[model samples]
Target: MSFRHLPSRALIASVLATVMVSFALRGQDLREADAQAMSQEAYEALQRGNAALAVREYRQLLEAHPEMVAARANLATALVSLGRFDEAIAQYQMALKEEPDNSSLRFNLALACFRKGDYLQAAQRFGTIHNGEPNNVRIATLLANCELHLRQVAQAIALLKPLEKSHPNNLDLEWILGMALIRAAHPREGLERVQKVADRGYKAEAYELAAVVYMGLTDFDKARSDAEAAIRIDPHASNAYLTLAMLDGYSGDENGAAEEYEKALKANPQNLQARTQLGIIFYNQRKLDDARQQFNEALALNPRSLLTLYELARVERAQEHLGTAVKDLESCVHEDPQWLPPHIELAALYYILKRPQEGAKEKAIVQRLMAEKQQHGPEPSVTGSLPPSP
Candidate 1:
């Protein structure tokens, strides 16, 4: 998802519009001819798509007339266009101190934070603006998306339901609301909303979302059908292929699963699930070198991925690289303290390395997790018996 979708408008255009509006000089007493010339040059640089030049000119302009609020705001916009979000944020903050009531500055600030992956901060900024301008659909939508990213499914659902009710047939809202509902374990209602988008020409994304819901329901046939529809709409629908591959694996057709995973990678080489699962297949077949290669490639794609780290540690352990495996597993354990798989594997590795005390501690945690699972009773897992071929 964005930083995933808006109300069917290009975000870049919005950014440009903000910049154009903020380029108006507020006529400060200190605004001299040199400062004006620099501002004009920076504006032209941006108009000509020379973002680096724009940044340079803006910085120079600000150095001369530090109190020029328009220059500061434009500098932030220029920095944002150059993908220097932290610099943009700093500029926005400084500009806000001068004109604290400027909603446009706050809006741009929220967007910069979103681009920087600070969803919580973005949510806070957007929330404040939304509160003041209760009818601003864009800020409301953005706030809902931030909630979605933070896994605040209940809040996202609550925020979106009224929006969808008021703004009937907004596919973007429907898509976002459907995601929240599905995450809240209301698959049927989510499927209904997503299907509306599919019927209205947002076929690929809608069908892909539907396939995920069906997969969760363990309705492999419907999942495959929806996934195939998505791929037909857009052959680059990597997640659809990923769902298909997962279905194939669950069906016990290893060769089919591998082929589907490869198809997924061909569609999107950076797909983490496809590469990781394919590596697990290789590991199960005892192709240690191939598995190791895949896991390493997966990690290279995203070093912060705890799943990939855990999987790579498993391969290292299988290859008898005990010490290397321990380092990776320990990192995983530190990052994902509540996850049972990493803890379980780390416990085994500790015992293998003859760290009996640490191993016993990990074993105790695993025992506690098992006890919790038992108390919760059996949750529905792989809800269907069979995965049919597409």
Candidate 2:
């Protein structure tokens, strides 16, 4: 009921109404006071560069005033600053629950998801925000990025094409679309387009993308050069070092790769990719125990990483733990059947162990796949042989 229409009918009603009005007024004053104090605390924390403390205060404010949108938004921002991605996502989701139609909240949630590697969810969330704000460059760029990670390269291309046209000569869009094209299997066209952008002083990101494309195309020297250029552009770019390590590994320079990976880890201690790459380098160098340790460490950080599991299984096989290797391989295959390398390794292991029946079954699968490849005629070479399962 409207406050103006609230009845003051009887003696008890009048007393209750007065008490209720006083209580409501006092509650409003208390909320205002609390909000002011929290805001001041947040500002002070920020000025002191104590992001973690700011996050705590903002979180407290949010807890006490669930409907305070400003507190909630600032809390999400603080969570990001603290690298608390999951917490930030939760807070953004809570904010969205209260304001479901808020595009900004949705965008923030998408960004949090992206940081946490939930690209598919991020892509979907960004797509919703894009629908609401079609011309938002940041949202569009993020959606394109999410599409690329989700391997929907064609969708990324489609999303960026019009944006590029509307804002002609936008280097960021051009280079992004170029990478999407390359990932989508149009390397020649993609490289040519990206080269144009690279020449226009959009060098660092463009070179990094070029490095990845060169790696995909098996042009190791070119990959190394571009990766080096990326490093020159940003001395502390962990990605450039890690990618260079991959190039070294692929080119059979174990020691060089190890050194590059060390630099990568030095630059970013949380570089799981670098750690995994280092593990594989050690594995290839016949350091089974070291490889296993690295894989274990990486798995501790990301339990669901099938690559780490596969690597551990491979290391176990190398150490002659056939049963353990098989168990891990089984888990890997069960989790992700489309990963062809694990299947090939599993089949090869069965063969090596003289389990002819099991070997025959796996052989049949590979042979069938090979037959299909032959039927298609002139299939592309599968690069980089996987280590045999011990």
Candidate 3:
């Protein structure tokens, strides 16, 4: 060929070099050995959090030794660090199959299950681990969360009772156990337990939780006192103010509730719960425009707030805006069909609107939910006599 028309030798040489390199790397025993060594190196690297390097090594090792449990477990942990929970779960499964009783593997598996939103499976695995090491705080916390999600309040409380003995001074353990007790319908006992912490001067937050517990127990005087104590300690505690407002509302002091909600707003201008409570207070006091204003303000803060939606529906109903009320109530029902108050209010609103059949159906739903709640016990009376206004 003429030199001018000849192929570029450099191009041909580059392709040939790439082909030879590919062939040399393809299935060579030395290459496989090197990969295994690198995987081991990656496992060590993971201890130092070099996730990128570890991923490459472990992936190569897995290609050759697919059944290696140590490699698989390390890979799973590395996958977790890489935010690959699904892949981590698959790897953890393989490790668990190899060593069925590996607690660490099970613990990781449980966490992975939780991250995947497979809470039931996570709860079961956590329960098993808890049974083996009953005093493990992490597992207990996981178990409690699962129980709460599943609404197995009694089981959660029972699971936590033993933890109280071992972790007597653990603040979180006590708080969780107190909440579990309250959920299990022992609000009086729960408040007492929480008050013990508050009395010990832990923080104003304990007093706040204690106030909520007392409210649940219908011990309004104590609830008010505890809530006030929280406010006195930390004027910025919005929860304490919100709790006091609700307690006042339940005790038929709409004006007092409104004032407490105002204080709550001063502490946290964006407190949607307080705003919604203020709306409810206004609604109860027949201040229709003010109620609507508060609800609108709350909705502006959080368009998706369930309480605000429900209160807006209530305010609409009271204003005789039947269609708008129906729409708002429908939204609330869609958001939280399990909350008794909304269903009851919806049924009442429908009846008032002359939709007797729809009202009856809603009333039936309320009755069903009430029956279920009754199985727990007579509802604790959050309503109690308020001390004459100071």
- Per-model TM against the reference: 0.71, 0.61, 0.58
Ranking by lDDT: 1, 3, 2
lDDT of each: 0.85, 0.80, 0.81
Residues 7-91, candidate 2, lDDT per residue (tens digit)?
Answer: 5579678899899999999999998997889888986886688988988888777777778876787788888877889988888
| Deviating ranges (above 4 Å) for candidate 2 | 1-139, 146-152, 168-172, 192-206, 249-255, 265-288, 291-318, 329-356, 359-370, 377-390
Provide the lDDT at 182 for model 1: 73
Each candidate: RMSD = 16.1, 9.1, 11.0
Clashing pairs in 2: 317-390
Best-to-worst TM-score order: 1, 2, 3
lDDT minimum window of 10 residues, candidate 3: 381-390
For model 2, the run of ten residues with the poorest summed lDDT: 381-390
Model 3 agreement with the true structure over 250-318: per-residue lDDT tens digits: 777878888888998999889887888788778877899998999999999999988788888878877
lDDT of 3 at 10: 96
Residue 313, candidate 3: alpha-carbon lDDT: 85
Q: Which scores greater on lDDT, model 1 or model 2?
A: 1
Clashing pairs for model 1 are 1-4
Best by TM-score: 1
Question: Candidate 1's residue-wise lDDT over 309-381, tens digit each?
Answer: 8988998999899999999989998987877898899999999999999999999999998898899887677
Task: Indicate the residue-level lDDT of 72 in model 3.
Answer: 84
Candidate 2 versus the native: TM-score?
Answer: 0.61
